[model samples]
Target: MLLYTESKEARRDVVRKEHDIIMLIGDSLHDFAAEFKNKESTEYQRGLVAKEAAHFGNDWIVMPNASYGSWSKSELKMWNEKAEK
Candidate 1:
């Protein structure tokens, strides 16, 4: 189904319908589904991802989000050229 709306419930209803499997191609976590929306914290979101780790890259195709939201306040590690051995 081609859903083009801002309502989360509408999207959820589409998902509830019995039919072919739906795949979500999203840049941000919120675009995936209703369950992953309005999360408490980044850590909590990460936990939810971990909980449904198997579906990633298969059912849900994740793309890098350019516009920061939850990760804006995160501390990122510096990239290293060589192995830290």
Candidate 2:
């Protein structure tokens, strides 16, 4: 199941709907998920979600994007190196 909410409270509310598991998947799951390259907001947003999930006693998973994701800077550099080779 998928539930989209704009605020943290809303996200928690959705989790209360009684689902087997909740998975938050997206590019901007957190501020850093989208702004990781900015250096100013590189902290993982998944951590925030994880904390919230714990507080709500909800089962959740945060799936990260590798190609163009928050952690893509290193992967991008590797890909660029291969392209150069």
Which of the numbered candidates is closest to the native, going by highest TM-score? 1
What tens-digit string does per-residue lDDT give for candidate 2 at 1-85?
3345465545545666775334444444442223223344333544555546562323334455555755554323443666777
Model 2 alpha-carbon miss at residue 80, Å: 27
Lowest lDDT 10-residue stretch of candidate 1: 76-85
lDDT of each: 0.73, 0.45
TM-score of candidate 2 on Cα atoms, chains taken together: 0.28
TM-score of each: 0.67, 0.28
For model 2, the superposed segments whose C-alpha errors exceed 4 Å read 1-28, 31-40, 44-50, 53-58, 74-85
Pairs clashing within candidate 1:
none
How many backbone overlaps does candidate 2 show?
0
| lDDT digits (tens) for residues 6-52 of candidate 1 | 46647666667865656877777777766677757767887888988
Residue 30, candidate 2: Cα error in Å is 3.9
